[model samples]
Target: MSDIQIRPVTENDHAAWLPLWQAYLTFYKTELSDAVIASTWARFLDRSEPTNAALAWQDGKAVGMVHFIYHRSNWSIANACYLQDLLVAPEQRGTGVGRLLIEHVYKTAKANGCDKVHWLTHETNATAIQLYERIAERPGYIQFRKMI
Candidate 1:
């Protein structure tokens, strides 16, 4: 396993975050823009922004990224930490980068007084599901979405 350094995203990381964001979009086949990604990065770096914390680092010469947010809910005991985006460059996959990101998220959730950590992945992402199953309970609910 490589020594994965995990930390909160900084403004300067925008250039580094681009490829990972693109990979995440490609992984899901979504077409998003640089401007949108820029805005998202701004929101993440803003301390007052509700859900903008991102974790990122250079895996040697390559970059890996993770973004997450905490949300309050009526049905939950405490705030739920939702992992908004997580992506490891294809070259870095299967070498512990993903696991490090998830572990970092888990620790972040616990530190923030969150009762749980939640995220959804495509049903077809078998490798991710394997890791998630080991660390999280699959909620018996399907996600519904609408473009705003």
Candidate 2:
């Protein structure tokens, strides 16, 4: 963990970031069109976009990634950060990479004047839920959504 370095993604990091992104989608059992993937990567590189991404590197390799977005919220005057994606390489799980990535988001959000940082994990992800519970409060809000 001491050797792990987490930093914002750069244009040169696309090759390293793609596998982590693909692994994340595979973990969720989902797939996206190439266009959507391209657009997402573009947004991360665009400073004007609220979407942001960072990668955790170790031994000259990307071990994890996180994507977050800042958006307005009626509940608070300051913007809220939505941690949309987080993933650690299968081999790196339980090695503190996930927590490090999440902490990175918390720090970034606070620095950007965000009121809070929030995210959702599948209810079945017990391992992740254990970590999440230890670090953040469970708001007890059941998510309701429909794919339009």
Candidate 3:
């Protein structure tokens, strides 16, 4: 979408990013503490930190956001970037905002020399799945997670 743009999130955007962050949690029906939200925003804004991104407006409003971190990858000798969270305002869904956010992540990963950018969403998130399929190859391996 011509109206959308992706940029490194700055500290000045924390206030704008919060409601979108909360919405991302709400989309998954989860909750997070304000402190954690504050910390995450601070971490992303900190230039010293590695591998993070957010999508904002060409029109000057924060329409959507994505936050990812780089980490070791056993499959690749080079590091990989993992998308931790992505959110588009509910009103902005289906308007190409999600794909733009994803493309931004890929561009960021490429610029950083990452082997790949990867992430997962709930199986039931059909809308995102549809968009994901359009932009990237399907994952061959299934994911399993356990909280220790």
Give the clashing residue pairs of candidate 3, or none.
none
Point out where model 1 deviates above 4 Å: 56-62
- Quickly count the clashes in candidate 3: 0
Please give the ranking of all candidate structures by lDDT, highest first, separated by commas.
2, 3, 1
For each candidate, the alpha-carbon lDDT, in order, equals 0.79, 0.96, 0.83
Put down candidate 1 lDDT per residue, 1-148, tens digits, no spaces. 6566888777777667777788889889999776886688788888887775555466544457888888998997799888978888777778787888888889988888998888889899998888888878888899999979
lDDT of 3 by residue, 5-110 (tens): 7787876777788888888898889998878777777788777888576866758888999989988887888889988899888778888888888888888888
Task: Tell me the TM-score of model 2.
Answer: 0.98
Stretches of candidate 3 exceeding 4 Å from the true structure: none
lDDT of 1: 0.79
Candidate 1 vs. truth: CA RMSD?
Answer: 1.8
**Model 2 global lDDT (CA atoms, 0 to 1):** 0.96
Tell me which of candidates 2 and 3 scores higher on lDDT.
2
- Model 2, 5-120: lDDT tens per residue? 99999999999999999999999999999999999999999999999999999999999999999999999999999999999998899999999999999999999999799999
Q: Which parts of model 2 are misplaced by more than 4 Å?
A: none
